[model samples]
Each structure stands twice: as C-alpha cells, then as structure tokens.
Target: MGILSINMDDPMDVDALDAFLKIAEYRSLSAVAKLYGVPKSTLSLRLKQLEGELNTSLFLREGRSLVLTEAGQTLRTHAADILGRCEAARMAVAETLDDASGMLRIGATGEFGTAFYSQMLFAFRRRYPKVQLDLSFFSPHTLYLPERQEMMDAIISWDDGNAGQGGAEQLWTDRFCLYASRDYLARMGTPATPAELEEHQAVMFRQPAGPQLWLLQRDAETLSILPRSDLFANEYWTVKYFAVASEGIAYLPSFFTQIECERGDLVRVLPGWESAQQRVTLRVMRPSALSRRMGAFIDFCRDYFSPGYVFNGPRYYVETIFNPTNTTQTGEQR
Candidate 1:
C-alpha cells in the first residue's frame, strides 16, 4: 500500500521484461521458456530476479499454471508495455521501421458496420495486438466529417462525402438486397421483380412508409423501385429482425444477410437486379499528419485487405482520388 522506490538507474531489462510478460500471458513458466527456446530453470530464475528487483512476488502457482498475484497482474501490464516500447525502439534503429502500436479511433454505420467490423477488427487486433481500437457506430448521417473529428483516424462508410478530404482508401463495395423470412415468402409470395414489391408487407427504415427504391446502377439508365412497407424503423437491425420474424420484406445489404441467405433463413428476392453500388470506402481523415502508430494501422489495412493478401468474396477497392462531395468513394481496394 506504501509507495515503493522505483529505480530507473538500472539499464533496460529487455529480456527479463519480455520473459515476465510472456510468463504472465501464458500463465506457465515452462510455456514461456519453451517459447523463447530457454530452459524452464533459466526462465524461473529470470522472473525471480525481476521480482527481487521490484521487491515483490510476481506470481503464485496454481496447479500446473501460474496466476498473477494482485501485484503481479499490475506488473504484467507495465511489463508488456515496456516490452512494446523496446520493440519500437529497436525498429526505430532501422529506417524501414514503422510504429505499429497506438489507439485507432474509427466510425461506421450500424448494420454493415457491425457485420464486417467484428471480423475486420478481430483480424486487425490479432495482427497488431498492441494497438488500442475504439469504434463508434451510427446510422448513415452527415454528422462529423472524419477529418474534423481528429479523434477518428479512419472511417469505413457507405457515404463518401469526405472521400478525398484526407488520405482515403476504399475497402469494399456493398449491395442492398430485398430480403424476407422464408415463411413470410411462402405465405406472401415472392416478388419476381421490383415492380412486384408493392404487394408484399414490408418493413421500412426510419419514419418512412413503403419500400425504399434502391438504385442499382445509374449510368445508361437508372434502376429504381419504391418498396411498400407497413412497419418502419430507423435502424437496419430492426428491419432485419422484423424480416427474420416473417413480418415483411426489408431491403438490406447482401453482406449482412449473406449468413441468413446461406442458411435458408432469409431469401433474396428479384435476383439479377443489380443494386446500385453503395460506395463502401475507408478515408484516412488525417493521413499526412498521422502518428507513427496510426500510419502502421493504415498500412496494415492496405495490405490486409489487398486482393493478394487474402482471398474472399468481398473485393477491396482503392480510390486514388478522394472526393469530399459525394457520399461514397469511387476507388475499390478489393
């Protein structure tokens, strides 16, 4: 409970610090030792030395594994951080080094945001475990320009109003589809085309009635439809839930309904109707002014989502030009 004398005079204890952190993470001395290709005895001795220096017992044995004591858990936190700094310093020695650790603030829409973010975020975390991620989700709105927020390092959005404002990158393109519960289709009958959509009971988005026409392509000709709905809700999740419950037909992104469609829970009506592209883009709001850590994250995304990096249905598109006017970025990074 008393303040302990902290010693900074000691030369950087990188090895011991790394060992302790690893041990704490694995909760096993043998595991840490094996990981570092060192004997368990040496690992145990190094940990003990660290404890002695700090004048505290860092861990307690419980069965075959080690559990951090109250003091130990606190030490583990610091040790991991210290090790991270050491790695960064080592990288700094080389001109090619990039800082890969820091807090990255991101914003996105609810449905599509939740669907892709969970996986994209998970993968990013695994690759850059040291980076702290903060995400905010909202319905599509021209609220805060990603650059103005300053806090938001990047934005993955369908709206490209701020596309070229800062260094921007496009992640993926999203397609909206008319979806309904299987049971509802069996009873209400499936509409063969957009014109037929009027007859089905529908769930609409936000304070609006009737089905919203999703423009598929607008170059040579404009493809649009007016969806009729009895129930209206602001959130995409709400529409999805209602659709799943056999309430009515809801227009939603294919990605969000992909799982359900595959499982036969939801069916895509009016196949071959190309939904106008909803530009799914990522804009680096503060690219040039990015901190070293933020830069690393941007680089990670560029590579992680690159076509060659991983193969999947969702393609990545990179728009060279950043358009601050339009709602979506034209570049595809997929």
Candidate 2:
C-alpha cells in the first residue's frame, strides 16, 4: 500500500478538500451547500473528485443522513491540518509583501480618539495607503468588554491598572494638571496651593454620575477637592476652550494642552501639583500573529510615544512653555 495523494495544483481539488471538511463537520452536503451559498451539485461533484483522487469512499449515505466511512474519518483529520498549513503559508507570503492591504478595525475612547489616536491613525494611513482604517470610539468603561474587544483588531484605551489577564501594551502615561488662561489667573488671582482652589471657579468634567473629586498630589501629600464650578462639560477640548475664554480653572491632561500652553492660550496653574495620571495602552487581540498593517501600526504608535519623542514628555507652564529661552520649536524642553 502506498500513501494517498491529491493534486494540490488543481484549484478544484483544493476546494474539494475544503468542501469535504465542511460536509464532514456538518454531516450534511446539502446543509453545507446551503450555508456556504454553493450549489449542492457543485459540492457533490467536488466531494466525488476528492474521493476519486484518493481512491476512497469518504462517506456512506443511509437514508437522509450521510455518515463518514473509516476512510472519511481518517481523511478528515489530515484534511484540516493540510488546509490549515496551506492558509498559514498563504498568510506568510502576504505578510512579506511590501504593501500591506486590509481593513484594520481599531477602538478607542472618544477623548483619546479625537485628541491623540486620530492624528496617529491619519499619519498611518498616509504611510500605508492600501490599508483602510475603521476607527470606532467607545466609552472607557465599555471599550474593553469582551464583546466589544472582539469587534476590533486593536484598541487604544486607558489602562486603569485593572486590565487583568488582558494583553495590554503600555504606550505612555498621561498626567493631568490644573490649567487656566492668563486672563483668568489675572482676574481671579492664581492659586498658590490646592487650598486656594476652593476660592476659584472650575470648568468641571461632568461624569455620568455628576462631578467627581479632583485628586491632586504634590510630593508625599495627596488632596481631593471638588472645586467650585458653575460650568460643566463632558468633552476635554470644550473644557479647555472654556478655561481659555477666562471662564474658570480647568483640570486637563498635559498632552491635550501642549499647543495651547505653548501659544500662551492656556497656562498650567500649579506646576508642583498633578491632578491625575492615566496609562495609555494598546491592546492587540493577537500580538504574535499580527497582520502587516496592524504590526506597522503598533510599531508606529510605540515609536510615536516612546521616551525622548518630542511630543511624549510633560509640558510645564513656567519651565517648558513660558520660558522662551528653554523651549524648542517642537514645544519641548531643550
């Protein structure tokens, strides 16, 4: 007895193996045809061709049902492995091609999507013109849910130090600090300490459950304050602009206010204190077997937010932004 052989060069024979697997799994030729939208005759013909090539009776029909013969059971095991390896080889070739082409689905929070990842993704599209991006924004709470995570190839989200067992790659840590317009500071008087924040009005970030306490830290001391606020907004940019218009002091992330601080549109209020810190992370579903497009995107983002990158560091009002002699053209300290 010799080993069985099927002509892999014949496309129909290859497809026949696939049809055989489907039929074996479903145990119904008509059912597989209906599910795959292929004609029953086409599947039957392919199955017969596959059986002929191997000189084996793959299936035995008993009334309305088809049961796998001993040969079919044996072929089933090898067919899946053969088809799987073929797919792997095809993907390996595709990954090596210079141009990566595919639809890459990504998820991020609305704030981060608008303020950060959107710009990064725009640049990615420019670099890989063939890759189509489908970016969707979700709330931080629901962004990483298993059902939601399944829909995206990758997700950029805040790592609240609770992403247990979930593969999350830390991109960068963003710090939030108090900010106010020069005019607001002049009119309301700049706060010298967290104690003075009680006297100043605040542009609060409205949460679903109403305003939350602003947690500020300096050295070993930590203080939580609910600043006096008549103004409230859910969006970061809106809060920044509201503060810019001399409405009130705003607690904002350093990354989002870099440009405004550089232009003297917004001033960091307490250089010694930081309100909050959030670790940004990239969660790729399958890191080991990433597509070329996704791999390029992950690399680009890692480099974009890497240490010593111009836009990756903290921007201070008194030191980096206001000090004309110390700041560079990229809005970072020299």
Candidate 3:
C-alpha cells in the first residue's frame, strides 16, 4: 500500500489545513467561522476538501456537537506542529525586515489592569507606535482558565506560589499594608496595636471566595483580625478611592497606593505591620519564536518594574522625589 500525501503546491491545501485545525480546536465549523469572520459554508467546504484529500472521516457528528474521529486525532497531533513551524518561519522573515508592528494581546486582572498595567501600556505605546495593544481585563478567578488564556499572548497576574506547570516570570513583589486617609485617622484616632483594628471600619477587597481575614505580621508575631467592613469592592482602585475619601481604613497593595501615599492623600495606618505579599508575574503563553514587537514589550516591562524606577507618567511626583536634581532650586538653596 502507498501512502497518500497532501499537495503543498496548491494554495487551497494550505487554507483547508488551516480551516481543519481551527475546526478541530473549536469542535464546530460555525465557531471557527465566527471567530475568523469567515462564512460557515466556506469552513465546511474546506473541512470536507481536507477530509477528501486525506481519504478519511475527520469528525463524527454527536447530536449538536462534533467530536474528532481517530483519524482526526492523529492529524491534530501533526497539524499544530506544522502550523507552529510555519508561523515561526513567518515571524523570522518578518524580523529580517526590522519592523516591530503587530497586534499584542494581553490579559490581566481588572484591578491590576485599571490601577497599574493600563498606565504602563500607555507608556509602551509612546515608544512603539506601530504595535497595536489589546488589553483585556478578566476576573482574578477566571484569568487563568485555559479558554481565557488562549485569547491572550501574555498574561500579567499575581503569583501566590501555587501557579503549577506554566513558566511565569516574576516581575516584582507587591506588599499589602494597612492604609487610610490622614483625615480618617484624625477623625477615628489611629490604632496603636493590631487588636485596635476592630474599632475602625474597613474598606476591604472583596474576594470571590467570600470574606477574608486580615492577617497582619510584625517581626516574629502574627495576628488575624476580622474588621467590620462598611465598604467592600472587588476592584482595588475602588477600595483605594473609598479609603482616600476617609470612608474606612484600606488594606491595599503598595504599588496602587504609591502615588496616593506620596501625595499624602492616603497614609499608612500601621507602618510597622504588613499584610499579604502578592508576587506579580508576566506569563508568556506563546514562548517560542516571539515576534520583535512582543520581545520589545516584554523588555520594556522588565525595565519599568525594576527597583527604584519611578514612573515618569502625567502626575510625576515620584520622579521629583527619587531624582531631587530634577526639582527646581529654591532661593534658600541658591
């Protein structure tokens, strides 16, 4: 018996192969069509042509769904490798032209996306104007889901030391600490100890797994307190806003509060004690043969989060604080 080979010379063979791969991935012709903005009939015809060329039935219709046959499973194994190699070759050729232009899809938690990543992305755009940025915000719980992950090239998330399997590069560790507006402390009277937290109202970060106990640590001692929360928000930005409004004391990440703290809009309630420490990480979903745009963005982010790199964004107070030479000299100094 002779082995049948697909003719690569025909352009239709390539389109059929691409269609077959997408259909196999989504398990539906309509899904593949809708995703790629192609007509369902076109995908069906391509899939049929592919199956005919291979001389095998690829899919079996199971009620409302389509399941891959044994032959389809075998083809899928090689199809992904074939497409990946083709893409690698394409990216390599594109790099030779020395152009950093492409769509970079990124995913992050809503809070982090709004509070920090959005600003960083804006800064990135100023440098690479040709690269289009698509930032999608997902819930903390659903951010790591495989289906959601497939939609993004890179994902920025908090690594609590339990992200198993995938290679996630640690960017920085953001420490959560107690904070409140100075006006709130003046009105409520600042707590001298951890136990005194019960007397003050809290503006808390609402967790999907229900209420969380605040675990405060100082040196060798650890204490847990369930403060009465009047304001609860899923977004850290909202919690910080309420805290700045003097609604209650907030336990927020230091990264989100840096500008506020520097501006004296919000003051650390208990400077000596710290709460949770979340390690921020950037996970590149597609790690092989990264495009020039993707490589440039990753490198920019690494330097942005580096130690003592004060953000020189619109409200540039941190730059003045970090780089005193940038500050205007007063008459007293002159």
Candidate 4:
C-alpha cells in the first residue's frame, strides 16, 4: 500500500465524508443511498469528489460490484473517525436542548441497597422524574459475575477487589463491628476481651465461597476471632434477627447496627476493637460513554453519600431490650 496525501488547499466535505464511510460500512452505494434517502448517483458523485481531492482511485468496479482500492480503504478509516466526531458533537448539543431522560440501572447487595441506598434512589428519582431508576439487588458474591456486571450502569457496594480492574471509584469507607442483642449478651455474660470471644456462641455471615474471617484491630493491637457457633445466614438482617433471638454474636456493618446500638437492643462486644475499614466505591462496568441521564445520576450519588450530607434515623427504643423493668428479674434467656 502507498501513502496518499490530501491537498491542504481543498478540505473534504463533511457530508461527503459521512457518505463515504457509510458506503464503506454497507459495502454497497445503492444500499447506503436508500438508507440515507439519497440517490445512488449522488453518493457516487460525492465519493468521486472526495477521491479527486485526495488524488487517488477510490474504488474499482467489477460488473455491478464496487471494490475499494488500498488508498480507498485508508480514506475510509479517516472518514469514519471524522464522521463519528461530528455525530458525537451533534448529540452533545442536542442534550442541552432536551431534558435528560433515560433508564438507569444500578446494582448492589440487597443488604446495603435496601437498607441504606434505597433512600438515595428515591431522592435521585425525585430530581429526575423523566429518568426511570431501576435498582437491582443481587447476592454479594455475584457482583463481579460477567452477566450481572454488564447490567449495572453504576454499582454501590463494598470495594470488590475485581472491580478495581474496571472503572471503580471509592465513594465511602465503612467498617464491620461485632454486635449481639442485649438478650444474647445477658445470656453469654458479655465477652469483655477479644480472647473471650472464643468461648461465646457466634452467628456468622457465610458468603457464597466460604465463611468470612473476622479480623479486628486497635492501633498496634489486633485480634483474629474464631468464634464457636452453629448459626449462619447470608442476609445481614437475618443475622441481626438471630442475634436478637439470643442465637449468637454477629458482626454487621456499622451503618446497619447504628439504630440497634443506640437503642441498646444490640451491644458492642469489644469497645476497644475496630474491624478493618472496607471501602465502598461506585463502579461502572457497562457502557463505554455514559448517557446524559447516567452521568447526572453518578454526580448525584457522589454528593448524596458525601460526609457532609446530614442524615439521621428516627430514634427507636424497645422496652423489653432497654429497660430492665420490662423483663423478668433473672433477665435470663429461655
């Protein structure tokens, strides 16, 4: 193949360039002409003008079939790129004239999305009534699965290690904490130290792959908890329920246990301990260029989850859990 130079004295026509690219794509001038609502003769004439400007034979005809020459193939590459930029600019301008309207699909674990993020979703919809919001809550382990990954426009969940390979941005940081209902604590006699956790019956969250290990730290000190237990559940709410039923000690996200803790329904096992902080990031693995609606949604999420965003849950207190008078004198489990 030989290099062909365009004459700077004469620039190519944008419409002609678009037609040339379309002809290259369809491989038939008549087909492209009909698609564009133009005559076949006009398509050929424009392409000839483009070829004339470049001073090369654009195509060779064999009977009714047209084949592109080496130079024509080169021009086709440049023409497609030039045409794409024009289309993109047109779309960008058109967005400013119209409201952002489209469907946005987000993915996250049922535990986090339903408990915390649902509020954010409702707020987002209030701002963009024209844009439909679809929040899909899936199992935690399935987040990185190829099919599920393809469905989310944006995802809000714990930083999945695999997601870093794609477009993952850390939105917030949170830590898990050991929590057990007052009833359970009363029955187990409260594990004052991390070492005492070994003797206490523990309720644990089992992921799809296996049980998650419990690691806690405080400054230079650290502890690895291997609690003895029989109770297990996948859902965080279920784990909380089991703990409330005096089943065992459960470790849950701090945000989820905040209400329970404040009301004294659940007590922190080790006040000195802090679980390793897990980062939560907004991940976008689906489309290459986000639509206007999706971009607006992402921006809304960043601010909504910001630390400065004031949020407080309604104060709730249970008489049986918080007041000794409401319970039996023994305060002992059945």
Q: How much lDDT does each candidate structure score?
A: 0.66, 0.76, 0.75, 0.73
Question: lDDT of candidate 2?
Answer: 0.76
TM-score (C-alpha) between model 4 and the true structure: 0.63
What would the per-residue lDDT of candidate 4 be over residues 33-146, giving only the tens digit for each residue? 776679999998998888888888777777776778899888877776686676567546646756767567788867665567776777777778888776777765777687
Which regions of candidate 1 fall more than 4 Å away from where they truly are? 1-99, 138-143, 146-148, 207-212, 217-221, 307-334
- Writing each residue's lDDT as its tens digit, candidate 1 over 283-330 gives 766555556666767777677676687524342211123333323332
Q: Find the number of clashing residue pairs for candidate 2.
A: 0
lDDT of 1 at 135: 81
Model 3 agreement with the true structure over 288-321: per-residue lDDT tens digits: 8578988998898898888866666653211112
Return model 4's CA RMSD, one decimal: 14.2
For all predictions, the C-alpha RMSD in Å is 13.6, 13.4, 9.6, 14.2
Top candidate by lDDT? 2
TM-score, one value per model? 0.58, 0.64, 0.67, 0.63
TM-score computed on alpha carbons, candidate 2: 0.64
**Which regions of candidate 2 fall more than 4 Å away from where they truly are?**
1-93, 160-165, 308-334
Report the candidate with higher lDDT, 3 versus 4.
3
lDDT-superior candidate, 2 or 3:
2
**Number of the candidate with higher TM-score, 1 or 2:** 2
Stretches of candidate 4 off by over 4 Å are 1-98, 286-288, 311-334
